[model samples]
Target: MTAFDGIGGAYAENLPVIMISGSPNTNDAGAFHLLHHTLGTHDFKYQIEMARKVTCAAVAIDRASDAPRLIDHAIRSALLASKPAYIEIPTNLAAAPCAPPGPISAVLAPERSDPDSLAAAIDVAVSFLGKKLKPMLLAGSKLRAAKAEKAFLELAEATGYAVAVMPGSKSFFPEQHPQYIGVYWGDVSTKAANNLVDWSDGLLCAGTVFTDYSTVGWTADPKGARIFTADMDHISVTGHDFSRVLLADFLSGLAQKIKYNDATMVEYSRFRPNPTLQPAAEPEAALRRGEVARQVQSTLTPNSTLFVETGDSWFNGVQMDLPDGARFEIEMQWGHIGWSVPSCFGYAVGAPNRKTIVMVGDGSFQVTVQEVSQMVRLHLPILIILMNNHGYTIEVEIHDGAYNNIKNWDYAALIETFNAGEGHGKGYRANNGRELADAIAKAAANTRGPTLIECTLDRDDCSKELMSWGHWVGAANARPAAAI
Candidate 1:
């Protein structure tokens, strides 16, 4: 049940995943025997039915004759749509005789754009790109879903336009590239990057979704500005919508026609004459969010995967620079509080060679803290940076309530119980910058299993972006009903 929402999130983030689970016995569908896993009922179809709301395909393998077709169809649908698919196997079907399985080679062939639509989208985009002040390019999360991040990068390089990635699309383009600007998340965007992008006469947004979350509570103005958007299956230009013009095809086509221009980058350099880095808090000073971030930033190595939990962690983690070959994972689309704890474990399990770093708030940490024991049992060397603030700070920023508070936990000490003298998991408390640095060093040294460093934080401490975002989002949510 918990996995359902996260799987649904993949669809909104424009990613693909396959979820498989077993349903109740189908033979006694109407016999209400109050099965243990059936939510106090005998309905065997609720699992598939609920999945249907979020997955591109949801199917059951009831008969051996239907297994191969149903499974193949579910996979193909998921891949083609870049969304999740669910497969349910009944308990009775587990031991049923079935034919030998064959290889599953469902191919997602490159889809071509409609010729006329492609030509028009390219022409419309070049009108913006070919300007004396070349338009800026804003890459969105869908670039990965469309499998067009490479194409998007090629387009940026060929056109010489400055590129800024959406917060959700972190690390899609090499952040170290000369043509790259910082994130373009409206008011939360880096000042120089925000100015450069906003001042442009025209902008081309590729594979972007402009929900309230992405727009920072409808305060972002990309769509309101002079811009054209290219999505997975269509391109919308000024007063024109071109359907069936796939994002990848449009990028390839536009790259062939657009002229090179570096005006945007030139302006960016002048606006951000000297990149600023505030000095870290004195080593013995109490740990603030930014100071903890600074310490974690120092620990990022090449090819490490970062898992940022929802809440203020989103704001902090997104600001960190990911080394080349590093990846960023966040469940921002769903905004599920506890998504990171287990997701980090899963990522570490799948890519054992890469270090997995997770930053989570105290409230969210408690939601799925049990996953830490599994990581210890598997002896996975993952780093968990926990902010022990005693309550849900993000919620308080948005809408304060009694429910926002949570009992404080001794998070660092709790990890020792998981370690149980046999496991290699290590836990430490960091009350200051020096303690944080020391804990990280020890985590790096402990190569056998996971490590938890619970950094103490003031109850009200949070990123400025979160406060600003929460203010706007709260206003939007509280807006009174419009007169019909």
Candidate 2:
């Protein structure tokens, strides 16, 4: 028997995967009837039984005529459970005729969130909103997938709430909007953003998977604070009952139902970010890489897309100023180290016409470096900025004494290694601000394939603000009971 661990164990939380397997039919005379060592033993029910442990639902279909209904039930189970499911198809039935398409009937599941529970949650949320001087909204990816962006924006605008988007959900709400705060997660997140989470009287999560990475390991507060969550599955809250579970579809509809008033809008405007955060500094040679990233922001056309990898490069990548229609993507859920390359491949494929750029650190670049071949083969007009600091800089901050170091790579040479020749694509190296600017300009001009800019910077150069914020947050988390 073959065991399949669906993608949901760690990687895919909300995604549904259906696994189908083939088994030899017992009715066939030529099939061996061996119970222990031979093929098709134990009636093939054990495979389905084993699959049941990992899957939300499982079934075995022996007859050819029942294949359609069995497959339909498996799919329905997956959607309803919002998790992985499986089905075992007999080898003999594999070649059988499938039933004609039937009238599609929507599977109606019971209301996940009770009306009274929703009312109670709304009451608690409203009470907290009335009391708090400054409250904020932390929007997640599920909300974007459910198409609740507009409604979420309206809610934020109506309630005098500042918005802090999670890394994966960056650009869900326009980054340039006055009410928008920066991305949260990792050491790069702003101190003010973490403060907003800690001090807020109410923390409302809509369509967000409240995982450890997103909440920074529950370091943010939840107790006594009003918490209202809307998700397709039943998520346990400290004080709430199971009745608080909400269907993703219904939550979106409810968001649209609420009306916004002018007075509410005026109140929301009060929380808009102060303009002092934006600063101008001379482009120092040591800070050339980060400065170039900021400069690239200005070159972006409307609706340009940016994808950032995890590591030192992310430190500067998040600081890039974006235009109104620009979008940014980062892996906040898994925090997988080498995701930028493949993720950029996926993004470029999905949005072919849009300008896509990936920012990666030297250490992260090597993990999935081969993805450059994919970009070259497809002729994607993507730009890659390699921040070659020679090692893992973020790890150094996390554990000051530990050696989480890495060997260096001649990053620009990888373009040729991947077979992207001069006419197809070119690689450039930058050691200072002027060279970095020239490299970026050349990349912007190249419309054929991807370009890689390897920027050499001193290892000592790091984001001081980020380091300070990390220390403050860590110390706050370690404070004594009296401090709380």
Candidate 3:
């Protein structure tokens, strides 16, 4: 039940996760015995039936002979949908004998688009690409789920248009790329990003998702007829649907059919990094949000993996550029606070060889702080840089009210209580820029166990971009009543 409750976001994002569980014995399933986990019912299919609502496929392995085929079907369905799949092995059949696995093949074969439909969509898209004076590429987070990241990047390289990622796709593409602009979320976008995208005569959005939060509460500019969209199951141009297409195949085909141009390269060059803009002298007294962000960026290594929490951290963390070979994860569509803490625990377990760093806010950290004990128990090298702003800073920025305030916790001290005064783990509190830098360095060097660094900041100090985004979203949330 707990797992089911947390799976909807993964399903909506089309993330692939396989869940296997042990079920009641098939013999007892229909007998007088009432299971400990199930609702009082003779039918054992209720749990699986409920799971089917969220998962792409669900199956109960009642017979040993049927396990192989059923498991294969669930895996293939999950891959095809890029969503989760559930499999249950009855306790009586837990040791079921199955044939050895077969050689690897295309489990979910690529479904080709109709030739005429594909050609027409591509022609319309190509016409827009070639004729338009300003064309832009907006990549979405689904490109990562579809395993089409490389193909999408190739497409961006081939078509020399400025590329911007959606808010949900902050780290999907390399931010420091030559043609990369910034995130494009309509009104929530940076001045340069919104301007370029709004002025674009043609837009190519691949694997894009547009929700109220991502679109500034549904106040984003509507797409015109010059937009090309490709998803996992569909490809379309100007609302003309091209069915049964795969994103990777569509990108490959489009790459071959188009003549590459670099008209937008001039605009892209204007957004390139300017070293002179960086602060010449570090603030030795007070620690600001921007300074904390810069410090986090300075500590990142090529092998480090970063998880940014949902809050003002989104705006600050997105400012950091990912180094080569580093991995980044953020939950934008779900936007659930405190998810990173536990998720980073799982990440540490999966990749023990690499260091895992988490950027979490004080309010959100309170929700999932217990996960830190698991890291300490396993001696995982997880560095938690906590932003102690005394309340839900994101909410205060969005809709300032008395309800948004929270009781402050001595976050760094709690680490000692969790650790039970053991020197196996460490905790540090930093209230100023110099102390914050020292704490970061100490945490980086301490690899024996998980270390927690609580950096205190003014409650009102948040990234300017977050404030800008919050204002727009707040206004949208409280829009004037519509006429009947």
Superposition error at 159 for model 1 (Å): 0.9
By TM-score, rank the candidates, best first: 1, 3, 2
Candidate 2 per-residue lDDT over residues 1-484, each given as its tens digit: 4235323331254445777787666474355365443353545466677777777778788776787787777777776655677888876677788776465563434334576666655554454445545456777776654446776776766655667766567777777676676765544464246545555555666666655545544554344545656554443334654455454533444444433323322454455345444333354454455476666666677658888777555556566657888887776565667778877886799899899988887878878888888888888878998878777666555445435567878888778877635446668988767777788889888887789999887775667644654454445556678844
Scored against the true structure, residue 254 in model 3 reaches a CA lDDT of 74
Pairwise TM-score winner, candidates 1 and 2: 1
lDDT of 3 by residue, 1-484 (tens): 8787556667876777888988888779556688788888877787898889889999988889888788888888888888999999988788877776554454566446677766766676676688888787888878887777787778888888888888777767776677778778775574257667766778888889887778876766547786778887678776577777777767767777777776666865666445433352254667777777777888788788888898988877766677766778788877878889998999899899887989999999998888898887788879898999889988987899998888999888887777776646778988777888888888878887888988889988888777877888888888899999
TM-score of 2: 0.74
TM-score of each: 0.94, 0.74, 0.90
Best first by lDDT, ranked: 1, 3, 2
Give candidates' CA RMSD values in order.
Answer: 2.1, 5.9, 2.8
Global lDDT scores for all candidate models? 0.85, 0.64, 0.79
Q: Quote the lDDT for 79 in model 2.
A: 68
lDDT of 1 at 205: 89
Task: Look at candidate 2 and tell me the lDDT of residue 223.
Answer: 44
Q: By lDDT, who's the top model here?
A: 1
The model with the greater TM-score, 2 or 3, is 3
